[model samples]
Target: MARTHTPRSHLSVLHTSASRFASSPAFYVPQTLSESGDVASWKPISYIQFLHDVELFARHWAHVLKLDGIPRRSVIGMWLSGMTYVDVLHIYGLSRAGYIPQLFSIRLPNPDVVYELLSRANACALLVDPSFEGLLKSCPIPTHRAATTVYDIDSHDMPLPSLPTLRERDTVFIFHTSGSTSGIPKLVPCSSSWLDSAITKSHQIAMPSGRTKRNQDVTVWMGSMCHIAQTFMLLGSLQHGACTVQPSRQAFSSNELSLMIRDCGVNRLNQFATFLAQHLRNSRQNPRLLALLQTLDDALYSGLALPREEEEWAHGNGIRLRNLFGSTECGAMLLSTRGPEMFLQPLDGMSYAFVPVASQSEAGTSQGGHSAPLLELVILAESPDCPDNSLRAADGHFHTGDLFQEIRTGCYLSKGRDDDWIKSENSLRCDTKAIEDNIRATCCDLVAECVVVGNGRPSPALFIETNSDLPQPKLKREVLRRTRQFHSRRYLHERIASADMIVIVEKGSLPRTATKGNVRRRVTEEAFRTVLDKIYGTEWTGTT
Candidate 1:
């Protein structure tokens, strides 16, 4: 029998299918399932079978938590990794059952921190992957004493029943920000309507053609499922009925990813800049990638800035690399394709506004003592002025806290975060993004990622990850020389002299989240005090 394709104007075609299958058994397909003892693979599942699993899980969850009597909007926390398909199902099922699903990173430093976040969210139930069971057991929250219903996927013997239909406006998931620079990450509740909009917008911006709807075009993801970028891609692919290729437990090797790209026949590839850089560096000598490169249609880079040479290499290989700018708080914001103009175009159905940061403020705080500089984001509104604190030229636009400048006609280049700009003694200001761009342009093939941070210190510091296997001293000297050559001599002297130290690390040592690499966190934890002390022959507490 031929499957029917229903067209929708505002919603994605996949969302329509999901809604249509909510009550019908014929629509479910068991695409992902556990095979053998521990292995899992994608198998065809009927819409009815999938709904059965959802119902069973939802019923068990509600009964376990006594949610039968609780009101709607109750928070349920999900602390799991990306490998588990059940996590996706559980989230969707919970939303269908009228509960709010709070998604959190399992990378919390300690169990206490995890417990504190869940407790603060007032989560009524907690769904955990088996790997973190020990952490949960060690936490102060007693398993049997709390109102939370614990759903453990590893223990499949547990009882969980199914639930009925769900509402479109119901909150589906809640994501908390990483509190690296400020107070605790606040919970951002997401509704079905939001997901619908996000999925549609992402598909339009990413795939953008009926060709994407074809079965042969696979979507590749490298980041963790916890990160919104990965989440968006995973959900968007599933909704579009496109195949998704997930890397194994081992971090994606350049060889491995290159192979997967060819094997899966991936047409649309999305990943962080770091991942792409590492893959390119690793596959520099591999011959198979040339063929894989031929099959790839769109190569979308997000999470960080792509090195200029890497971008050129991809274009040289016939792949069009597009830059995606967005956050977990906001969905896809800006996209730039490979063209002579190379301007970032605002996504359709979404508008942006920006608020300028005060020049004197620091990176993680505003002049008013707020954590992080304040940039009002005006959503659904347009802006004519890019960085100035001018009055609203139009209504309905949000003022975004991110700093940006219109460098060319219709091209807005991102400066650093409002607080991340470094000011030299000569009163000259440097944007980290600009510095990163300069480093990429000068070093081209040597550098992977570079971060410039100035935190109420005398000199700004640059932390760089290099692709070459050169020793630390040689790499440091090379970086310093390049820095002097690329930047103005006076600017380099003022900045480098005021600069405390330059730290070089191997690729992949730096910490990265789903959206952006945490340069500050990596410096403080991995390089600064520990690595810098050994290199500089002193204890350092200069900057964050």
Candidate 2:
């Protein structure tokens, strides 16, 4: 297929989803565990009430934005703590009033990064949640205020503020890049039509074959309102009349998660693969939850491919975990595979190819038959939801920043991120995926994550995390065992680097994307700079 700039657009999502599924149930929020630490009963908010909430919020939200000098189509920054039905309402209200909603995760500890996003978006004012009020005060920006929460779902007859007219092509959403690779944040603007398509695409790509039992199945949204993935999942559930399940603000204990699965009958989940791993592990501990998993319709995940072990675990447990590929800039998922298929050869309608980097010399592209040259994965699609202003190559293809090797017709295997490609002074290259894979497999039980760093050095260094309980002696021994195993691979040969340089960090010390669980490579390098300095005898300039 040839690349083309033209894409058919759709109507605004906010005003139409309810009418499209007028008979569907709205959303389901399990009350937070009470003071006594008991799970609360499930409550369902109807579409009627949802619309009323949107209307009420839009009218008043618009007034507040206007008073703060925010005009129609202004980008509004949101510092979100927890995702709720109200946050969903906030997006719709902002869109309805012609204010574009952009989210900055409160999970990120850096106030400077959050402030930079507000500055980049030229946000009129930052609307922060009450829980994030203290965090917002330090973020130097134009101005900030606490946004209204949806305390009551039942609509009151408060004088409705009139909604400003919005356009289908209007930029209604501005989501920041995960920035796990780079600690700094950049914005991805989403138009109303883009979200409109995402709402429908979520169904087409994610819905189980021949099943539309509206309000019967529930979809768990694991991302916060500020994260890009959450908005689509919320709207997608509402469109299908499927109940949207809210994850606990804090990580759910294995027992609590089990109860939610049993009680909520959560058959579908759209979240990072890491969270799913915890659920899968917990299900093994709880028979009822395992039974629930056995009957799951589908599980959609992004962030990174599930560790091969986790993917195998899902299949052995009788679950079909699918992979979703997209970025905030792509608007929504540009490519998705059904079930647990791991290969990413593009299906028809989307054209993908491996190409040499734009700056790579002609010598780099000249390859002998014995070995294949390293190339970047690029995509050319007719997705109208994405604006043309997004990062793109001069040729118009969206360079996904992923690396892959086309093994055969319509099949390709992932090689970590292109930025993770490492080249030593001797020109010997090592794949980050291979290292991470070995480390993960070796420390599968004790390690929560494994990051291979040393893009430009003689050998790679491993930064791993695990539960704080593991004795330092045991942790060191296990990591050393893994390091030995990693180097034992003759395929990597002498390219293998330092194993004794392993750093065992406490949990949560490594920077992670709030929703995606992706390790911020650059951020982690900087965060653990002191440790790396002590080990390497100088500053650690993290690999790109």
Candidate 3:
């Protein structure tokens, strides 16, 4: 029998390959309990079967909603968690049906924000998780019922159908920015072609071989499904015919994660740095992690900043940690495999370029200013024609709001956000990340996480979390000394003199969204109101 291969287009060649794989039993590895005490064993499905299921769900959705011949640009909202295979299938199905899937993160703070984002994005239908249906129903958005229709994916009991042909340039999914601490979540449309390009580029760059072979590697989904980085990793794995091991929605302990790592022989682990840091703290140096690391070929870290200590720890454990720099708007742009060497490399194959801001204009200042310190990303800027104009540039480069500095050869260190940098009394500017890094270097053993916030106030406040056993007075004194040591070299002693350390609640006390550590809201609500007032004997109220 002659094998059929779908033609690649601007939409997505990787998705087509994945669909083809799902049809045959050659790629099928049924779910089985491993000898190791892991919760769920790796279940590999045939690419053909996967495509068939996707087509069935697509047909069912189209028939139920009476949406016939809807154009490729039609938007469908997907409210799902990362744990289910259906989430990935739903995205592929939407692509097959020539519809753009708008994936909503389960970690979004509330339903109102979700509704607002959906309405703003002009979603035509919502494929919701049954568990979250109740919350969606309560959204106050009146026009939601009229403009958008709802489809319960969990409620469906249809059989798998034949797959449909899809174009590569057709948008497969839409990822919204996590508006946890920043502005409202904006839609970032991703074409099937983009996914294919990303996968091809990443594979070429990483050059996996031997046990790092496509089929043998185990990819774990650590971050939220809503995060683009994790989605990209998932798609990349599916394309390479790798086994994916994802944890359940229920609380996952570090011990359980270690078990899963060992049971699955997970070679490739992709996740947020914060999650890995937490895992490193919670899990002891067990045989499982050690065994997994022995066989581990590569690991990728992103989302939050990867601290030096954590990176060093991973390297010490014989794991190659690739620090990746990417955004929801522009897929995966940068991969730092050889640590800082990645920054010195040229912009090759869908990469990022730092555009120095020439001068500060009214419009530029409004949009975080284009100063020497601020590097405007020239790749994947929003279309100027669009009303919202979320994207900054159009010449294939987008102006990333993140601030960075070329510290030395091959190393470009990230400073704090342009908005978060605080100006001291002597007109000296202090980057919060720099301050946080200093604190971490000094109190690495005691502090789990730290966030520096300079609200519209005279001095920046350092919110530190220490070990429960550490005496408050000693910890405060140590923190002050560290802060002084950091500022002394910069000759900003008087400027930072007013800076104060506020001992926030213990680790895990702060609130967090799916992709971001939202310290602003948490500090204001929890630390300022409850703890700081009691400790300092003053009500510290400031807008963050």
Whole-model lDDT values for every prediction: 0.53, 0.60, 0.53
Error of 3 at 366 (Å): 30
Q: What lDDT, from 0 to 1, does candidate 1 have?
A: 0.53
Give the TM-score of each candidate.
Answer: 0.61, 0.68, 0.62
lDDT of 1 by residue, 71-114 (tens): 55687777766444455556655655557767765544245555
N/CA/C clash count, model 3: 29
Q: Mark the 10 consecutive residues where model 1 has the least summed lDDT.
A: 383-392
Flag the better candidate by TM-score, 1 or 3: 3
Q: Give the Cα error of residue 117 in candidate 2, in Å.
A: 2.5
Q: After superposition, how far is residue 62 of candidate 2 from its true place, in Å?
A: 1.7
lDDT of 3 by residue, 1-544 (tens): 9964443432254446555555433122225444443455555566666655566556555544443334446676777774556665556555555566778766553566677677877776666666676666554322121111123442155443334455544555678654322224566766555555556555543445465434455666655566566666655665555666656432355665665566656666666555555455443466565555546676666654554565566667666667666666665555564543334232255545665556332122211233234455445433211111345445444566655554444345454344554432211234566667777888787677777654322345567667646687777766676666445433221123432445546677665555566555334445455454454343332222
Q: Pick the candidate with the highest TM-score.
A: 2
Root-mean-square deviation per candidate: 13.9, 12.1, 13.3
User: How far out, in Å, is residue 10 in model 1?
Assistant: 14
